[model samples]
Target: MRKPIAPRTIRGRLLCPRVDTRTVDHLADGLVEIDEQGVIAAVGPAPAGCAVPETVPGTVWLPGFVDTHVHYPQLRVAGRSSGELLTWLERTVFAEESRFADKNYATDVAADLCRRFIASGTTTASIYGSSHPIATAVLFAALDRTGLRAQVGMTLMDRDAPPDLCLEADAALVACEALIARWHGHDDDRLRFCVTPRFALSCTPRLLEGAGRLADRHDLPIQTHLSENPGEIAAVAARFPEAAHYLDVYARHGLCTERSLFGHCIHLSEPEWGALHAAGAAVAHCPDSNFFLGSGVMPLRDTLTRGVRVGLGSDVGAGRTFSMRHIAASAYDASLLRGARVGPEELLWLATAGGANALGLGDRIGHLAPGYDADLVAVQVQVSDPADTAELLDALLFSHATEPVRNVLVRGRRAV
Candidate 1:
């Protein structure tokens, strides 16, 4: 991978999600100075005696999106509308993921995935790779080339999967360890390894326990699915009859912790919500995916009121788009269907700062403030009235077509 270029200053209409207020902050005319180390040195009005550069007449600068859940191997299969979750996986997802066993094929797909991420303004994402170690390595290499921050893991499923995608517990653990050594914390910690067990139905007790042990030993984060659909939940209960509930199975295996990110938590119960809050685990709300699969809408109000951390995810393939803005719109619609109203501030927060907090990287990359990583996106704005920031944001979110992103910067270097 090539080294990033020297830092520079950018002046624009700055917009960011603030943690203190849990809202989006807009600065009509602002300057952001990045240091040589790819950190934000200062953010606000231009410094005294500093040379003021020309500003784009109508552009909005905001932190690059943080997509908390996505599947790297399923990129090609995205937008294939089929039956519900389990049937969709059997018909489309499994067949598509099985292609990743070829390293060359995986490499080619990885390039496309990274380019899509840049085009969609996603600077950071937590990715799920197919159950092939070589394929996962190829993905890391591709992401490293683009300087995109990410957490990737080899999908682990020792049972109920096609033989080509299944690995025994011991072999899976060894592969994960090797991946951790080779890629975890690589590239100045921009890349990370996650312990991903494709979810309970596909994993045996031994596999889940082994995954938890490996994660604890390496201090790595864990990602998995939970209660995405009714049939899936019933299958989990049938598979683990002794467990009190679906969450208990993971908790007993030492997988329920602050670093755990469970995706598509649509059918969770009240007690399950409490368990998540108590364990400090986070949820990745893939609303578009839920809508596509006919999965029930998640109760966003209940989850937030219970103090559980929630972030937005593309859940690509299952999710319709790579753009977090589209996901944000879906979230709003999902919330409304559940009798809750989500405003623009909350939606933007879920896409950026909320995702950072969910992935335990809030201080590093979510906000466009001093000391944060300089990951940002510049969007062309054609609003007739530039004075109303809220109106501009609403137009961007609700419109059928969004203006193309003018530029993207990651780690103080221009990425697109």
Candidate 2:
């Protein structure tokens, strides 16, 4: 049997986005108390009679990064770019995914995936499994063992792909139902099952419709790709000729709800932007993957201007690395290329608080606060001896490639 964790208080020089706003809250000296339930019971400077706090383990403590989109099976496929998104999928991605049918192979990779998440300082995420249900099950079991909070989905691809990788809509839904029964709401709801259609080009109309209805019945979150590439967009148009636009194809099948998360929305039309805002949906801006695959830069400003919820996604395999901080660094580059001046505070928010909000877990896990889960990272990062918030953020993001995560805590439990 597992032993109960003891409650403790820790002091730190911390910086995190506010739970109520995008602003960062920094304290050169601060204290936080985590209760037996693994919730932050108190957080602030020492009050009178608040037992002298223990020092934090790293240079600064920030809320753990939340990755809004990524693929579990593609962990080993990073950096094998084949010129474009669709061609890369055909040449590099699907072949790697097909190996997941071997349960042993899937299990080994899942363990590595969890380690990478911990090493990179991600406590919460939305992940994609390969089309195989057992492979997705393998992914969930690994996440559960590691104590990470994530929403995982099995990719649903019924048509327009290789036969070995494709399963009919009804069969795929049956597989999904089984996975849901086993993993949904497991372990005090730390993990959830998301409905994932592999986009319009890969899914049959039946698969898309059934996925939408299943999510409605189960009240689950949904994740899928959107207008990331122009060629891919044209193909989606050809595949769903009757639909109004790329986003409308999802809307037609009831998948464009507030619970939906669309990745790489680069070439969205004005009306599509309006629709995303009106539906109260969210977006996963995978700038690293966009640049890696020659997919055009997403107009980050357009998504922000529409007041749509947006979060950073590593979008790995194609996206270079699993670190969301690296993705945040790339987001700045993408923004600069698009002629937008997205601030460091905002980028920090997007990597942590904004991602949790995008995943609809804002109050539960985003920022450092009393009543929030102690899901945070301790990074050994510094540009100045006692770096201010801006200097700290810049160093953390810009030096992400080398500055490793010093410590990680999930619900106050040490995960690394």
Candidate 3:
């Protein structure tokens, strides 16, 4: 028989999957010690010769998911638009984003976005903010209140976008530098800055180059869309005729790096994939949005074989939900379209550790282990079968927000 632990205690089937993102150890009862710094000190079977304190029944604790791609400004437009990618961006996204020009509107929506992220059990996200500095400030302020970890950036575009969203290349770079100074490592490095150029279409070569330089100066993470739709691809090809391909545009500007995170690399060529892998850049595989928009399914297996890092993304607005679990299950479906199926363990890995690694934050968060932030969520289910762990995991991924996440913790404090 296992002995009891004396310190702060909670009893339930503890599923502490290792950092390797492999098998889970099912501790029928476990103890998790939260250090004073709000980090996980230790997790193990109840220590003998001690008393168990509080027990949470019928719940499993898992590392909170890291969403590598999402748009904070897109929350207002999330499920209302339907059309091709570029069309939706113009008719729905552009108009709604213009509202960010209003400071009050941006503040309210910023709070709303944070609330929605917490509601969906996403403890960390890489977010794209609108072009307005005040709007981005409002977004950051709202996120600061949530105790969540995130990397957010002002959307930088100097051409081919709504007039309200455009800024001169120098001005955009200056604003980016200021934001990095203020929030890049705020809240003990929980909130960070990302160097974001909305996409190739929205940024000229001059702007992309400036953004890349700012990223290098601040050493910030870079994010952008790439080859999401065929039309979008053709347009980029025509726009940058001097470049060999769409990815080459960014490459030429020195935007491709290990810290770069590209969203929806659906239409990448063999050369593009090779360059991405060589540069150690990662892809945020946004499955739901791709399926919803009829964007081509990302070739996950092919990318994996080519040795590129891939993570799940909600791609909100374009994606119907903010839940990374939904992203994980959607990825499974996407895999099936290619005559392959993603196993449950692999999907969980993609949602947590894999995603964290993709964002270049592997060691900081994304596992129930020592030296990692205590960002976690509790999922409970009553089942008669022993395989309920797998069932519960599957249910978490496939169910459309029906499964209750009983509690959420970020940095050892309750978030929900």
User: Which runs in model 3 stand beyond 4 Å of their true positions?
Assistant: 1-10, 21-23, 47-50, 53-55
Clashing pairs in 2: none
Candidate 2: global Cα-lDDT? 0.89
Mind sharing the TM-score for model 2? Answer: 0.97
Q: Candidate 1 — which residues are off by over 4 angstroms?
A: 1-5, 47-51, 55-57
lDDT of 3 by residue, 1-416 (tens): 11122323344556666675445556666777767677778888876764865355666777887888998888879886569898888888988888999999999998888877777778889999989888998888888887778899899888878788899999888888888888888978888999999999999889999988888887889999999999999999999999999999998888999999999999899889888999999999999999888899898878776778888899989998888878888899999997777776778877887788888988878787778777887776555663556766666667654566777778877663
Cα lDDT for residue 116, candidate 2? 96
Give the range where candidate 1 is weakest over 10 consecutive residues by summed lDDT.
48-57
lDDT of 2 by residue, 1-416 (tens): 22246998877778868876678988877887888878889888766665675465456888999999999989998999687998999999989989988999999999999999999999998999889999999999999889899999999998877887898999999999999999998877889999999889999899999999999999999999999899999998988899999999999999999999999999999899989999999999999999999999998876787789999999998899888888999999999999986878888899999999899998888888889988978887757666466788788888745587888888888874
State TM-scores per candidate.
0.97, 0.97, 0.94
171-282, model 1: which lDDT tens digit per residue? Answer: 9999999999999999788999999999999899999999999999999999999999999999999999998899999999999998999998898887888898888999
Report lDDT (CA) for all predictions.
Answer: 0.89, 0.89, 0.82
Model 1 has an lDDT value of 0.89
